[model samples]
Target: MAGNPQGHQEGAAGAARPVGVLALQGDFREHVSVLRGLGAEVVTVRRPEEAAAISGLVIPGGESSVMDKLSRAFGVAEALKRRIAEGMPVYGTCAGLIMLADRIVDGIRGQESLGGLDVAVRRNAFGGQTESFEAELSVPVLGDPPMHAIFIRAPVVAELGPGATALATLDDGTVVAVEQGNLLGTSFHPEMTADYRFHQYFLQKVAGFDNGTARSSRP
Candidate 1:
């Protein structure tokens, strides 16, 4: 199913190019719509075999621990990490960022991550779901209007290595967006915003990967 260009809804096209939404949890539908709006096929990703044909993937915000457990239970965690390591572009939102991080300071007990990106995430560093909010960011990769970001129980990028580029931050200098290699992780939910710029940025990255124009950045 797809969403609006930015909300939770279903897609009308089944034959479009598939972009998998790690449907283990929250905001998966919202992401489906954003990818759909970008003219890609939108669908929920389940087992490892189900991920074979997708060119790109989006890991949506939710309970990171639950998502971790679910992905492992479904036996696709290794496949995901392997595919992304091989150059597939990925975008992670909120809890999704936590999933992509190498070190998680506040994740669920004994939870394992995809470990594809090198960054540290502090879960709920900006507060809880009730404290969720939005802000306008000067995301150059996005465009002129600035990217509108929505954060719900979001994580913050604490420290980055040489491969990471800080894309956006909060007033106090909290790291909220970082690009480590082909992986793009955002502490906010662009899928919940009116702006498709963030979606556009990731789409461009995916396109670059598809065309072999993407520069490798491993740390």
Candidate 2:
């Protein structure tokens, strides 16, 4: 299947705009590698200022609470919320997906999120780390053969609003991927595997939509 991340294009001098992956936690390094492999400039998003120049952002998987705490401490949570609100293309996986959701189960207590995507998510809905599993999924946005997805302490989307679209799901009914306007999210980590399709798909979305332009809100 052919997948391309949006906004990135080959400049005449082989130049590329930088894309940043929120580095508060999770596999930020792997995401950096994945974006680089796609021939786009990559940067680690540690502070809001560092993220200001990037065309898009990826929120990597990790402890959702910790990410939220550090994001506030580092002043990124507000910036991220603002960026996405202003139209920066964002992608989140697992805990990252949880942060993007409108509501969370918060089994661990006092759970909070950035609440960008209009979806309700249950943390570790299919069980925690010990119950992690893999299955074939149909991601129509990617096309053709089912994509192999691995779920680790992942959240299952319970519901999404009219603006949201289901991009992929498991055979037994688990929302694996979703797109709400320029914001795209997934419960699985694509960087953990050899496939770069998901990342490419997100980049294509960013390039085409964000394009260094700030949108008023999620479309």
Candidate 3:
């Protein structure tokens, strides 16, 4: 269920702008809660118009194929792609990371993605739900204490293109988080933990983009 579309929150240059969370499916409510707690007006985006109203968006962890179908059926997929092309900041977590990848290694038949981040992702790279685990990742970009990440049937970046930079990796050197321009992606559920650094980092990207200080990474 989408949240009410009316509210004012301080953002870039002290301007008010809403941060949207794709609410067609998944743990969107968690993302919404985190963003709202961060003092930003949050919008639960369902329809295309809702997608258009936000300065930045967060695609939550959900079933990637189902999310893809619902977003297209609801007519928000194209709108989001357009916004990404226009340099709007976006943060994608877990399945959301798969949706933002340029290539999917093991997507279900006919499955599609929004395709913004320049990387190839292998769905279910860590196996089934029972294989889900937690890890403390050292993300230099975030600094200080390591980020505690939860992976639930998560994807992994198989091939990170030159356009994107790896933000965090596992002890085995497997890429789990990436960033490109105004876009950020992680194969773990940041919203599930107490740490809000990923969300805060994403908000900074949103602020920069909204202030016209962010350079578009799209080619």
Candidate 4:
């Protein structure tokens, strides 16, 4: 499906905005390519200090447990928490959603997160890798024509707290995408396709725009 080019209303001309992709694991390269294609400078973030330098960050799809281990091992976990608390825009795909979540269901013991979104995500809610599939999603925030979503052993937002807004969902009403303040979480991988609306939305609506524009706190 063709994406709406005008989905982003903040500033189409991507100038100095440098978006970062968490390079610790997963499909970070694909995200980097997409961001660069959108005309924004891209940065590969592997360290906490590096994470602080970018205007926004993308956590790609990968094993949630593995990502958690790596983030803590490399000291990126705490740093990310600090950044998100400061209202830094961050988008997470698949396991990325697991990382941004404040609550996780059936997670490993001692598993920690950056804790931005007030949602409960169940890992592998769509079953194993073999159960992976694609669907056309109607994301109202990005406007018409529906976006193609790629789900690979994806997690699902089983329960959204008072803070999060449901962006897209399955036909059965399973929450697949959510936006909470400057944080965006998707169970599907937007980097896997040609459509760039999701990334653009993050840049324009969350990253470039300040804290005042988004929900300051949950009501």
Each prediction's TM-score versus the true structure? 0.88, 0.88, 0.92, 0.88
What ranking emerges by lDDT with the best candidate at the front? 3, 4, 2, 1
lDDT of 2 by residue, 1-219 (tens): 213443564444555557889998887888888888887678899897876666788899988888888888898887788778867778898888998988886546776788778888888788878999887787877876788888998888888777788898787776778888678789998888887788887777667654444433365
**Candidate 4 per-residue lDDT over residues 1-219, each given as its tens digit:** 212211222333543436789999999999989887876677899898787666678899999899999999999889988878767778999999999998999899988887889999999997998999999999999998899999999999999998899999999999999998888999999888988888888777543343245433234
Which sections of candidate 1 miss by over 4 Å? 1-17, 214-219
Error of 4 at 152 (Å): 0.5
TM-score of 4: 0.88
Pairs of colliding residues, candidate 4: none
Over 96-206, each residue of candidate 3 has an lDDT whose tens digit, in order, gives 998899899989999999998999999999899999999999999989799999999999999999999999999999999999998999999999999988888888877
Clashes of 2: 11
Residue 130 of model 1 has an lDDT of 86
Model 2 TM-score, 2 decimals: 0.88
Best by TM-score: 3
lDDT agreement with native, every candidate? 0.77, 0.79, 0.88, 0.83
- CA lDDT for candidate 3: 0.88
For model 2, the stretches where C-alpha displacement exceeds 4 angstroms are 1-17, 210-219
RMSD of 4: 4.5
